[model samples]
Target: MSLTEILSNFHISETTEEIYKNTIKASEIETPIGKLIAVADDNFLYILIKLKSPDKVINTFNILQKELSSSIVIGSTKIITQLENELTEYFSGKLKSFTIPMRCLGTDFRQQSWNQLKKIAYGETMSYGELAVKLGRNVNHARAVGSAAGANPIIILVPCHRLTAQNGHLGGFSCGIDVKTWLLQHESKFKNK
Candidate 1:
């Protein structure tokens, strides 16, 4: 179904002085990758995210749809939409990681890192040191690269959880390490499928 159709199914009512206040509709679509959450407001696509949220997953989509109904189409991807669905199910404790197409905006280097992050495959991880080397940079650049990873606007769909410290410690996450740990364990448990 279309995004509008999905959003129309929700009961939305709220007002925010924040920029997201002008939204029109929002929706969540399930995909092989994860749950794709999209917000459309004032003719603009405000936020599209993929992640697991026990309480906010469904609510966020409804809220966003009613907030940004007018704005620019920030980005679009059938893969992302599909991923959203998968993630929603997973977050609801029904599934695991996802495989889907996703799009993001950032600097050249940040974009590169984000793209590489997507390839990190579920249940596996790469130390910042290893990531720096894969990016063809000296291991010393690991910290800098880690910073870039943290700045990633799109979180889970980018799979930033696959990155960690050299000692296999969960480092930092833009969305919170608790979420990261959950994702890692979830993926690891169902990775082979």
Candidate 2:
């Protein structure tokens, strides 16, 4: 049977063979800003993408379906639930840092950049050059660091929104510049309270 057929059973087998199967559970949750589609596996939360309209959520799911060889089932796990709660608190301005478990998928260099991205405190912003220097990379490595930041898949949970241009201009965000501006403004408004 196909992986999709297996996932349609709605119960994941814990056997060794089943464990080797890359079964991804996905679900969509609404937020104040918009709807976010979360895709995760049994042990780790994978990618979370934001959309301005509910209609576009499926487009992302379709893309993931093609990109990942795993079974992209429409379901949620305990970890996904927890992350959703954390997102709720964050968007509501009650949480600063996320406490949920996440296993980031990226290269060592990109991972280093993402780790530094998380270190940026809430209500604060840093430039790409500053982030690169903090990671012990040369100042000119800022552009490369920016590339890694753009590649980050976890989005708001990792606080990629905290990164700005050296002159403090809002930088690029995969979710769009408006969303970036909103996230920065949202954090700044509640970070001091």
Candidate 3:
């Protein structure tokens, strides 16, 4: 399917932001959970979705799509292939870190927040308040951190699923709490190995 069609299929609205028509490459690969949709430029993998539902996919795509000025083609690149391989290893519990080149788009704080999310170790989690303090923000910024976490485009590679509530509650995950729970459990299996 075409990029626009794919977006529409997921119930994403046509964005008012400039749509880049020819430079984006995307691919759909089936995974243990469901289909994963990935998009990338020549040098950076920009979007990766675990495909829980249209809402999360649309939210993530909209954030990354705004910066691209070309149409998204369904094909694989060296970067895409590497990402697929890494994801395979990850789901199989053999990979602990992702080495694929990636880029994120968002405001400065949001970008900083996503970058910090990448530092959360597999099978470990921290409250949003802890993340805010880690980011050098006062505790009040926890909500802002949560917002940025919600907007993370790179999903598992960046590990936004590792952020939780101060009381140890799984706050909210763009994909769904069940997926978040599964990811944490999956990572925990390999944590002490």
Best-fitting candidate, scored by TM-score:
3
Question: Which candidate leads in lDDT?
Answer: 3
> Which parts of model 3 are misplaced by more than 4 Å?
1-22, 53-63
Runs in model 2 with CA error above 4 Å?
Answer: 1-20, 52-69
TM-scores for the candidates: 0.59, 0.80, 0.86
Rate residue 186 of model 1 by lDDT: 77
Candidate 2 per-residue lDDT, tens place, 91-172, comes to 8899998887776767899889888888999989999999999999888998998899877768887878888889878878
Error of 3 at 137 (Å): 0.7
What's the residue-level lDDT of 121 in candidate 3?
90
Show model 1 residue runs off by greater than 4 Å. Answer: 1-81, 89-100
Cα deviation of 181 in candidate 2 (Å)? Answer: 0.7
- Number of colliding residue pairs in each model: 39, 0, 8
Q: lDDT by residue for model 1 over 49-111, one digit each (tens)?
A: 554543343454433344334322234444445545666776655554455433354568877
Ranking by TM-score: 3, 2, 1
Query: For residues 52-88, could you state the per-residue lDDT of candidate 3 as single tens digits?
Result: 5666666666556556655555688889899889999
RMSD of each: 8.4, 6.1, 3.5
